[model samples]
Target chain A: MSDLNNMTAAESAATKAAVMNQVPGPEIEGQSPLHHADLASLAKQGPKTSGVHLRELKLLGHLTLRCNPANADQLAAVERVLGVALPLQPLTSSENGNYSIRWMSPDEWLILVPGLETFDIETKFRDEMPGHYSLVNSSGGSTVLELSGENVVELLKKATPIDLHAKSFPVGKVVSTLLAKSTATIRRTGDQRFELVIRRSFSDYIWLWIQDASLEFGLVVEA
Target chain B: MLHIYCPHCGEYREEEEFHCAGQAHIARPLEPEACSDQEWGEYLFFRKNPRGLHHELWVHAAGCRKFFNMTRDTQSYEIKEVYKIGEQPSVVAE
Candidate 1:
């Protein structure tokens, strides 16, 4: 942990919150949460057609923003950077192009963007937004899994207690809940599609859980 | 398993998402320095163990990570209401 507390007054004042480029250079390949699972090989060798399709949206930039939703300036700053307003409604999401924002709580929102665009967005938020707020780059801490197909909901139902019925858990709704034995921030992308943002440490456990749950309905690995 | 309503998430989640945090509305003595040893001991150890209509604290661990109060019936295992922290509960034991 780098301490800003030891810095000189001028240096401290000049410094913005620490933002690093987590994405590795071309020479070094970035590993997805399930990289060790070697899904790429499975995609080529495993069954091509199955009731469930699993894909990892690997190495995306994940930023956790904590600020006052009621503040007009902060909201406008977010809109200016992402070209989409913060989703004020509970359990809702706002998306523009490759950038998507999930309402994590009343005052917290998780923003996902292109891996390379993280620092730029963080800098923009620091320069544009005013008052007390925190923007944390958690890109390395988590990864996303895209689950789709006919039996996707059924597979999720086996692990989580939340109702997967379309009437109850509609599209664009996000919920932070327990998936199997691990925690995940789940969002409904479409009628039969769901996006799971899960911790990197628990990724392997979730992968095993999903594979076990999807065995009844054949699993198709998508790179 | 009990299904708890998280006021922060505005949804009813499984008991796995929550953890019971003992009794609610137990205010600490403001002037701890002025209190005697017996008074401090009473403040630390004394808690009501009622049979019905108890106000207890709970945390939505997996969902919102917010602490809230739940008015529950100990005998029936029924939740009367869920409210956020710092808010008063509507249901009371008479």
Candidate 2:
């Protein structure tokens, strides 16, 4: 647990919002949501070639921002922090270097940054951003899985009801919808590649579901 | 499965993405103290079970998580129109 009581009065006032380093030092190994499954070992022993390739982009900073898109100051503040403006268009994502912002709703956006930069970004937002808004760090609550390969779209179609056609769901599009029995924020990174942001608790179920669904197509675990 | 349009998301998502929240436009009595037992009972328990065109409240649970109104045909299961929560239904029961 983090030391909330040990924080000084000035530090407490400055960081009214909670911010903590989720990743430990080099001595302590950090585990992803699917750590128990040992996908890295499976990647070493599993088939070299498969129709579906799965890789977990573990420990990224997941921040949920809720503010009026129409607010010019809020937009300017975000651009200053991320070096990129928020993607105001619905279902779109804007990326600059390691920071990517996906429009979750008219008033909400999900921003992803390097894990180590989480606290710094939060502090900057609190210090600079203006108006009634919310910035929530949800990195511990979810993890991102990058899926790509020949049959990747086929596997996703079996799980979700959304149309996976490239014409309809172009690259860079994001959607919060059902993936198998659980929910995932699915984003198309390429014609056959997708990035799924799923809950930590449901990660195991989704992994199992993907394995079962990919049996016919064959699954390749990537480190 | 029924495909419902989410006005907020401005796209048609699957029915699984949404949860039906029963009848829409049911306003609570402004003066509860002035109402009798029958009025209170009607307000709390009674709801219309219309078979034709019906107005419904639904939440886009998996999508935007915003609540909206859907004017649907209960018989044919056809969604006539979908609007935001505060907006009026363009399609109504005739």
Candidate 3:
């Protein structure tokens, strides 16, 4: 096996892996995980204001980047591509406009970008990144949801066991925890707004769960 | 459910998010082919079921998904300390 620690730039460049553009052309329209849920119609027909508000962020790029944190060169390459340093702090997240990076673990980060920019970002990582690393595009595997309003906390408390107080989960904090019975990578985007990155398979279950939980508080679906 | 601290996430999460992966620090034989049947069976099947303080491997399945070593008192069900992988537990069984 080649020594990853001492690999020269030329050696790293030669070890390029095949990367495919998963995003299709404009002719082939993409669909969000909850497309079947018909949220757009509900946004218009549903109550204008309620205790809890739910919106599907929909069709964003989800990339999982795994690299060595100890390797300064690898870290620099990531900064060059993303234009922001990786949030090495545990449970922290950093964002640059449409691009948001969440610290998933010590050596792993989940990068979210606009749907159309997914392929471009992946290509940038391939050309810029060096040494032993893995960047996987999983946009098709999951979807995003934005929940807010006065009773958002009350609705979330019934589903997840995580402490949602401002003291523990302040803004810009990200935690991958159980959302109801399924897993969700939740980020506190605002004081009241939270972004949940949930699996595509569990989207139906969670949608129903959220609807049921928000019943007492009142549910407002937005497009 | 137990309140377990995930060393990677640096926070306490409910026990449902974690899974106890049996004993910790089980070293595989350097030369498995050289070992006899009795030695191989002992290495594979035998485990230490200590009554007091125990070192256990646990994975934060629903959170950061990282494995860490947890020192716990099996009788009292108290987690003494949670440390990252590759680090020796300070509270070893006496």
List TM-scores for all candidates, in order.
0.92, 0.92, 0.96
Residue ranges of candidate 1 with Cα displaced over 4 Å: A1-15, A24-27
Q: What's the true lDDT of residue B32 in model 2?
A: 97
Candidate 3: the clashing residue pairs are: none
| lDDT by residue (tens digit), candidate 2, A117-165 | 8888988887767656778999999999999999999999999999999
Which of candidates 2 and 3 is the stronger one according to TM-score?
Answer: 3
lDDT of 1: 0.88
Per-residue lDDT tens digits for candidate 3, residues A1-223, read 9886677556765776677778786688888878899999999898988899999989898999998898898888888888888899999999888889999999899999988888888887877777788899999899999999998988899989999999999999999999998999999999999999999999999999999999898999988
Best by lDDT: 3
lDDT of 1 by residue, A33-148 (tens): 89899999998899988889999999899999998888786788789989999999888898999999999988999999988788788877767776567789999999999999
Candidate 1, pairs of clashing residues: none
Instruction: Provide C-alpha RMSD values for all models, in order.
Output: 4.0, 5.0, 1.4
Model 3, TM vs. native: 0.96
Candidate topping DockQ: 3
Q: What is the lDDT of residue B66 in candidate 2?
A: 88
Model 3 residue A53 CA deviation (Å) reads 1.1
lDDT of 1 by residue, B30-82 (tens): 99999999999989998888999999999988887888999999999999999
lDDT of 2 by residue, B1-94 (tens): 9988888888889999999999999999999999999999999999999989999999989988889999999999999999988899888866
lDDT per model, in order? Answer: 0.88, 0.89, 0.90
Candidate with more favorable, higher DockQ: 2 or 3: 3
TM-score of 1: 0.92
